[model samples]
Target chain A: MDDARLAELYERYGFLVHRRCLQLVRRPEDAEDALQETFLRVKRYGPPRDGGATLAWLYTVAARCCFDLMEKRGREPVAEESQLAALEERGDGSTEDADRRALLGAALRTLDGKTRTIGVLHYLDGYTQDEVAAQTGFSRKTVGKKLKTFEDRIRQLFAGRSHEARR
Target chain B: MTAPLPPSPRGPECPPAAVLEALSAGEPTPDATRAHVQACAACGAQLEALTTGRDAFLRARPADRFLRQLERREAAAPSPWRRLFPVLAAVVPVLVLVLVLGPRLTGDGPGVTWKGEAFRVVVSRAGAEAVPLAQDSAVKEGDRLRFAYESPEAGHLLVLELDGRGGATVFHPFEGTASAPLAAGQRDFLPGSVELDDAPGTEWLFAVFSPRPLQAAPLLARLREQAGRAEPTLTCDGCRVSSLRLRKAP
Candidate 1:
């Protein structure tokens, strides 16, 4: 993309990308770095061709950048307590939502990249399964299957954490 | 049988965050999504949060600064051909020499006299248009200042301030231990602004541009020693330094 178009893109969507990075990394400095890296990737590969899904596309890119930064620092993804609390508050006040929200970062670490991306799109961003499928270019069945796997992994993680806490 | 996925915490009628973001950006969205976002309190709050967060981000790290950082990062990486051709590596120094010396030889560029490094300070008072500060201009305690720099090469930059009461502080990167990366050949304003404190004295703003990252700790240490000097100078080998003096009044 040319400079003007790129500037316009940054002006319009940079906040969403920065917010996504902040959610994943939970550090202002690291989020800024990830935000820069996301735009650099955009400058290299160009924005997604699908105009409608641009924010979703940027979110995925920012998430990948945040994950890369976390890996580079040799640290596991750790959700801030405030973020987890916000997640719980936003959800229906159920134990399942609480468990899922509390263990989300750990559960996401345990899953593969594609599944984690799918999970974030559906659970975190509140995209419907159909919307997730459209954004990811996957069939609805595959999106459902991946989301199911993600949910199972979260449960497994919660069980393991509970077992450890009980011990 | 595969278990059904959990329903979204956001209601079924609520649009995705992406859709909300797009709507916030004034992009075209379906009427149904717009109506739903307007009617749903949760969705409305989400949209408002997005807007507030965006406004904060723009105020802190404006688009120009973000773009400059992007350009610097892109310029810092070597191209595939540069890696593949060892012979081409020899040509780079010659190219640098031409870029550094060519402007002086022709006297064609506006910054030819400054040796390709320029530092400018723009000051904004309450409800007034910002104007670039002339050398040793008078400023007030409540005045806000933004910095801009131009360089002949891509490098790391540190903007430091030496206040009248013998205090030295890093002005750019606001709170970092190292110099921020700067793009070459553009006179771009740095991210964020600095508001003058209630210190009444002559303050010196220094822009240190170097090809390699410089640690702020050592630089500040040296500046601290020289803070009381009538004219402070720092020794940074192979780095260009530009200084702006301001008389800060109470």
Candidate 2:
């Protein structure tokens, strides 16, 4: 795409991509690096196949870039609770909301890489089952099944917390 | 009093997770799924939670330094034509002259004699155009010698000059010298103004067409030593040698 179109794409979705990167990388600096790389790759390879899928496509690219960066640092894919808490303390979000995100991120860590990617694409980022399957190369039936299991696990986690608080 | 929920048969509550995702993505939901989401308070609360998380994440803006770096990348990329223009400027005129005069510069014609070798050469002075050199034709120092010639056959060409003071100069194919290939019947000039220096006496010009490209620098270096000792004997394999003498005005 030309610079005008690229700039327009960046203006519209750059923050969304940066946010996704920050969520995965858990560091603002690393997230910024991931955001730059994601747009550069988009410019080089052209945008996603479907223009409507721009945000979803950007989500996938940002996640992979963050994952690769983490791997290069010889770190695990598991979210660092301390770093997330530190970033949350920066006041980008409310403490309660940050706590909820930290819990959700911990929940995501419990899933395998493929399942976690599928979860992020299907749930928080709001891609359809077919779109998630297309991006993750999973069959729609498989995505439907994994998402069911995922939702049940979250429900159980919250239910057990409720039970413990009640006791 | 609580309002009644919209009437619809919900199949397993239509997967509230998918409905929530679709809603947040601004995708159209199945009518049944929409009905269930409207009726179910638990699903509605979950959708709000997901939207809150997504929106909060999107609040992070791309830093200013990143945009500036992209602008710098665009500015650093060189335009393709800019790199090719100078090469074209130097090559086009020689091509044009070859195309315009190729048919007329036959190697056999009235020639000039020097050291028992005859070579056809057309000479003109700096303000004179296409004036053929004749007996007693003389030019002063600082006057440009506009000489044109062709080879009898296709080969590598070199024009070497020996001044009256026995200094050897390579007059073709060096830096700032532009000429054409020695294809039979292809006419070319020694590019640009080739002015005569103040060595006032007889000067010999030799044009050699060789089967292979000659290295003029080393040959000229050796010629300089011989030029100071005696009349230099120069040789090249499969070379056609021709010569002319020009009178330098005293």
- Model 2 reproduces what portion of true contacts? 0.03
Per-residue C-alpha lDDT of model 1 across residues B154-242, encoded as one tens digit per residue:
99988898899888888887857899999988677887899989888899888888889989998799889887788786656657777
Candidate 2 segments exceeding 4 Å error? A2-16, A82-167, B1-22, B25-36, B46-250
* Clashing pairs in model 2, backbone N/Cα/C closer than 3 A: none
Lowest summed-lDDT stretch of 10 residues in model 1 chain B? B108-117
lDDT per residue as tens, model 1, A86-167: 5423322243455445455456666898899888877667688888899889999999898778878767766666677799
- Please provide, for model 2 over B2-85, each residue's C-alpha lDDT reduced to its tens digit, 9 standing for 90 to 100: 121111122354453434544655556678777777787756665666566555544544335455766665567577877888
Q: Worst 10-residue stretch by lDDT in candidate 2 chain B?
A: B1-10
TM agreement with the true structure for every prediction: 0.49, 0.37
- Backbone clash total for model 2 is 0
> Candidate 2: lDDT of A95?
43
Best by lDDT: 1
Q: Which parts of model 1 are misplaced by more than 4 Å?
A: A50-52, A82-106, A130-144, A155-167, B1-8, B75-250
